[model samples]
Every structure is written in C-alpha cells, then in structure tokens.
Target: MKLNKYTWIFVGLIAAVYLGILIWVRLTNPVYLQKNMYQTWENSYVMHPKSDQSFVNTSKNNDHQNPVALSESQGYGMLITVRAAQKGWANQKDFDRFVNYWLAHRDYVGDQRQTETYLMSWRQYYNRHHQWVNDINSATDGDVYIAMALALAAKQWPKDATYYRSLAKNLSDDILSYEYNPQTGALTVGDWVTRDSKYWQLMRTSDVMPDIFMTLAKLTGDSRWRTVNNTMLDRLVDLSRLHHTGLVPDFAWITRDAAKPVKPNAISTKYDGDYSANACRVPMMLATSNNPKARKVLKKMLRFFSHQQYITAGYSLSGKRLVKYQSASFSAPIFFAVSHHRGEGYDNLFDSQKYIFSKPLTHKNYYDATLTVMAALEGLN
Candidate 1:
C-alpha cells in the first residue's frame, strides 16, 4: 500500500524532529550531558539478581550473551554510583546494593569454601544448571577500585564512615598481602598468583593507578602503598621512554632493572603486548595523579596522541596504528588526559573529543559506554 502525500509529510516531520532532538542533546553543556549519560548508563546496565534483590548486578548491559556480573564491572558501578550520589542522581540504597553484591561474592580459599578473604570473586555467572556461581578468585584491578570506592564512601557519607572505612582497610590489607609483589613492589594480576607463579612478574599497564593507590595509603596509613605507587610510576616512565609513541602495552613484564612489553599470546590475546583495550585506560589513570612522574609519562603520551590523525582501537609501541576504526574507549581517555593540561595544543585536543562524552548511548558496547562515563565524571569537573 502506498502512503498518501499527507502521510509521507507526517513521517518526514517526525524524522526531522527526532534528528533535531539528537543534535540538541549532543550540544548541551558538559555537566548536564554527563548526568544524562550516567542515568542512561545506569538504566541500561544496572540490574538486581533474581535470587537476591539486595545484591546489584553489574554486567546486565547488552554486550554480554548471558547474564553475569564481573568484579571489574562492580568496581566501576560502585565508584560511578558513589560519585553519582554526591551529585544527587544516585542514592545510598543503590550504593549499598553494590556493596552487598560484592560482599555476597567474596573470594574463597579452597574446596571447603573457606571465606576468609575479604576480596571479591572476579566473576558471577548463571551456570546451565540455572544457579549462580562465582569464579572464586580476585583480580587486583577490581579489588583496588573496590577498596578506593569504599574509602571514598567513608569520607563522602560520614554517617557510615566507620563501617565503610573498616571494610576498606581490611580489603586494602589483603590486596597488599596477596596481590603486591613485596620484592618488586609491583601489583600481581590476581590473588591466584603466588611467588613461584610464572605470571607473578607480569603487570597490566592500566593497573598503574597511582592516585587510587595513594588514596588507599592515606586511608589505611600503609607505607607499603607508597612503594606500590612509586614502583609502578617508575615502571611507567621507563616504558614510556622506551617507545617513541610513549604508549604502554596491555601487559608488561617488570624486572628489577626494566619493564618490557609482554610477548604476544603471553597472557590473554595477541594484542596483549600492544596498546589495546587494557592499555587505553592508562591516560585517564595517569591523569588522576599529581606526581611529576605521572606528568612526565602523560607528556610523552600527549605528544603522540595529539599528532594522531584518528585515534583508533589499537596501536603498537613504536607509533604504528593497528586498527582503522576510531573508538570512544581510546578517545575518551585522551580527552580526559588533555583536560588536565593547559595549553593551546591541549585545549584543541580536548575540544576535538568533548563530543564523545555526549554521544547517545549505543547498544552492545558496555566497555565503551562505561569508560566514556568514567572519563566524563573525571574530566568534566
């Protein structure tokens, strides 16, 4: 059936109005746009487990094929929600749900299910048996972020300061006990890594979050946190100096004298040794630090990123581009990094990517959307 001219005109007007609304939203001020994005992000990803309404589900985004929750996602959710609460968009109730989800999924020791570890299990999934199961291991990245969130919550909501601080201190202690390499002062990937483990010396570049480590140090008064922060910063400087592009790899092996990119397929994937997804967070993480060493590392990276014609998904340490498509995961961090510096060069870089924070939500891109929100929260302020 053919539409009448009136019907065709009506359809055209509807499309035009929708397009106009999209443009208006994209052009709004940064803070307002960020709050909108955060709400959309929360609605799209945050879920409550059917078995336990009190616990939060962090991996309900469309990207995953089955329902699940990752410790990393929980960390992100907790931090994001805590910050959102301070801004009046999120509440203590939801924040408590995230905390409860973590508590209900703590990492265990052995077959008897010894639940001594305060650290959280890395993943929660529904098995084919239709039961929720945890991986029962801890990832340092997730643990660090969880500890940081708790510490922040202690200060942000003083009514519950004592409780949050206690939890933060306990988890921070365990992270030091199990995750830190005492001799090298570098973070191991997880509690599963022991002194004799082959992966003990491997460090993921994005885990070099000096500011968060410093926050943990101040909260717990642990001097060892300073060692972890300084050692990682030194390794980052060394890695940046090794490459003309100043790009850190997804994974690096740290020795007493130097840190080098891991060999391909050494850990998770062939991109493990390149500036891939994991390494893309380096810029935003480094931007959070006040140390001159962090600045030195970011300066080199800014130089490389500022000159890029298009920031793509992956690159080599030697300034070689590996992918053709641009990604918000890469650009948003660069945007945040540029926001920390002052100069005509940096300003232009910031302006070029400011629209990324305002991009309407896309389906099946959980990583990209999450990072974009994180970047916005940090950079827009």
Candidate 2:
C-alpha cells in the first residue's frame, strides 16, 4: 500500500521526536551517565586474578610494572569495592582481599619523627633502591579514608564485624590522638606537631575530610569527631569568604593567640592561593555534609567553576585560571558539587561527563584515573 505524503510527514515527525527524547534522557539522567563512568572506572583501573588482586596501572606505560599501591589509593579502592559490593557488583571475598592486602603491608615506624602506627606506608615504589618507603610520614587524608573504608567494611560484612570495627576504631583513635590538635581543633598534616612550632600548625585543606569525620562520629558515638567536622567546615567557609571568590588555597596556617581567636591564614608570602591539586577536593569533601554552610560553600564553588569553558587544572583564589590544561580529577569533583547543589543553569553537566569519558585509562596517569573513578563514584552517590 502506498502511503500518502501527509502520512510520511507524520511518521518523520514521530521519528524526530523520538530521537530528541533519547538525547534529552541521555543528557539529563545523571544515573545513566554515572553508570557509563563507573564502567570506564572498572575497565580502566580495577584488576582481576589473585596474583593481580589489586588496582594496577592500566593507563599507558605502567601496565607491565608492579602496582604502586599508595595508602590513599588502597583506601579509595576499598571504598569503591564496598560500594560495588553493596550494589552486588563485587563480593565479600573481593572486599576481604583488598582490605587484607593493605593491612598486611602496613609499616610501623617507631620514631616520633615518623608516623607512629601500623598504618600502610604512604607509597610503594617498584624501583630497586626503594621498593617501599614509608616516607616516614602518614597523610591524614589517607588515614581518614582508610578508617572510613574499614568502618564501611564492618557494616558490609557482619561476619567480620568485630575485627573490622576494632581496626577502624584503633585507626580512628590514632588519628584523633596523633593528628587532631586540641589546642585549635584542627587536624594537622601529619605526626610532626610541636607545641611552639609554626610548621606543626600548618594544615592541608584537602586533608580535612568532613565526610569521613562524620562517619567516625556515627561509628564511635563520639561528638569530638563531629567537632572536627564542624571546625573544618568553619575554616573552609572562612577561607572562601576571606578570598571573596569561594576558592580555597591548598594549604593554610592556623594561628592561635592568647588575645585572638584561632584563625587560618594562607601560608607563606609565596602562597599564590591557587586551587590546584589539593584544593580541588574541597568541594567534593564539603558536599558530603548536609549542613547549610557546607552547601553554601559548595554552591559558591560550583558557580565559580560553572562559568569556565573547561575546568582548568588550577585556579587562583580570585577565580583566575592558573593552568592551560583540563583534568578529569579537577572536573569530576566540580561535576559532583554541581550535582549536589541541584542548582539551575548548569547545562554543561553533560559536557563535563563527556570530557571525563573521552579517555581510556593508562598506566602513567594513575593519580588522575583514581580521582576520576572517585569523582564518578561521588556522582553516583
């Protein structure tokens, strides 16, 4: 039967409308986009097989090399595994292997100058002279995430609940005793605190993980953990307001005076207040809180970055772009923050997801790849 011209036109209109709906769904549904990102994360970073039971380098030149499992990487891996397990993508056995690998390889440096716990060393190099160096110092953020992962694993695997709970408790206690400064309610960078030293007073803004602190607070029933979160949130908001741009510097010095309240000033005369590698995580961290102040800071940051063509690798506190390159690590958190804000006029969300999905993981870019995975996970949450 020959169709009339009107019938053909009507059919064409239906097809075009269908196509447009498909495009709209792809652009607007964050869950669908998150699933694609998760697949990219799993394919590029996660490794299989007992012999290779770790997140190995799959980016570029490092595939043949032994996996350099940094403490933060292990912590993030465990957290990712827990999430996957909760979603039925992984199992208890997989979670145990990842957790036990890091637990067994932890270093115990006895000296006061170095980290004084059985925490996993910060990094493990494949090089001959330095197969694995403790770096003598533990990163506060690494420990925070590791502790959070353990707390999560406890809930995920009830059969091993006692063991995981104890581990998480000890780590959390150590972090409080060693890293938390009662004098200023600030979590320091490492175990290098001295009563009268300026260096001991310095804090890495990225090291302040409010979400992990909130988790610890719930786990331990201790209000101190909540206090730490509150203190950090206050500092972050103050810093954002101080610069008048809603951007935070990577590092700041917290000064306590007898006559004045404790205040965080951007460290050093040379400190450019550039939101670079470390400060990029600020929005990601803050978005974990339901507090109005936290959301306000996150919204301001989202607004600052929303205007850019691409989220540059670095930016000054004044909203000036500092680097010519765009990075997944930087963009992922911004994507997360924008999603958290649930604000209007953010049509670039799909473009941001596209940039993140544009590359396959390679060995050489493990840091960025890990962060990309983390950001994608954050968006999924």
Top TM-score hit: 1
TM-score of 2: 0.79
TM-score of 1: 0.91
State each model's C-alpha RMSD to the native: 3.0, 6.5
On the 0 to 100 scale, the lDDT of residue 367 in model 1 is 78
Q: Which residue runs of candidate 2 sit more than 4 Å off their true CA positions?
A: 1-63, 109-118, 129-134, 193-198, 256-272, 344-354, 358-363
What's the C-alpha lDDT at position 101 in model 2? 64
Cα lDDT of model 1 by residue, 167-235, tens digit: 999999999988889878889999888888899899999999989999988999999999999999999
Model 1 worst lDDT run, 10 consecutive residues: 50-59
Task: List where candidate 1 sits over 4 angstroms from the true fold.
Answer: 1-21, 50-65, 110-115
| lDDT tens digits by residue: candidate 2, 293-360 | 78777777777776777778888788788878888778777776666656465647635644564444
Task: Give lDDT: candidate 2, residue 315.
Answer: 80
lDDT for model 2, on a 0 to 1 scale? Answer: 0.68
